[model samples]
Target: MSTIFLAVGLVLVVEGLAYALAPSFIRRMAEELPKLADEYLRIFGVAALAVGVGLVYLAQHL
Candidate 1:
């Protein structure tokens, strides 16, 4: 649908801007991710994945 296309396009735009403006910060975050404790990292990853799935479900229904 047009709305889905627009949403995807906006996401790409924002992501591109972030990469252009803060590439080093992004890399630093990635590099430091492994330093996080396993349990805490797993919890954070699972919560983020769950939230992403919930957003997709809501987008489809709405």
Candidate 2:
């Protein structure tokens, strides 16, 4: 659907800006990611997923 494409496009734009505007910073974060524990990354991923879903719910209902 158009909504799904819009969401994907927005995500790509934000992701592109991070790399384009701060390539060095992005590389540094990528380098440090392997140093993080799996559990720590997993928890943060889950938290991000929850927040994203909550936002979509709010957008639809409110």
Q: Give the best candidate by TM-score.
A: 2
Alpha-carbon TM-score of each model against the true structure: 0.63, 0.89
Worst 10 residues of 1 by lDDT: 2-11
Off by over 4 Å in 1: 1-17
Candidates in order have lDDT scores of 0.91, 0.97
lDDT of 2 by residue, 1-62 (tens): 99999899988999999999999999999999999999999999999999999999998999
lDDT of 1 by residue, 1-62 (tens): 99779878988998999999999999999999989999999999999889877988898899
lDDT measured at residue 13 in model 1 versus the true structure, 0 to 100: 100
What TM-score does structure 1 among the candidates reach?
0.63
lDDT of 2: 0.97
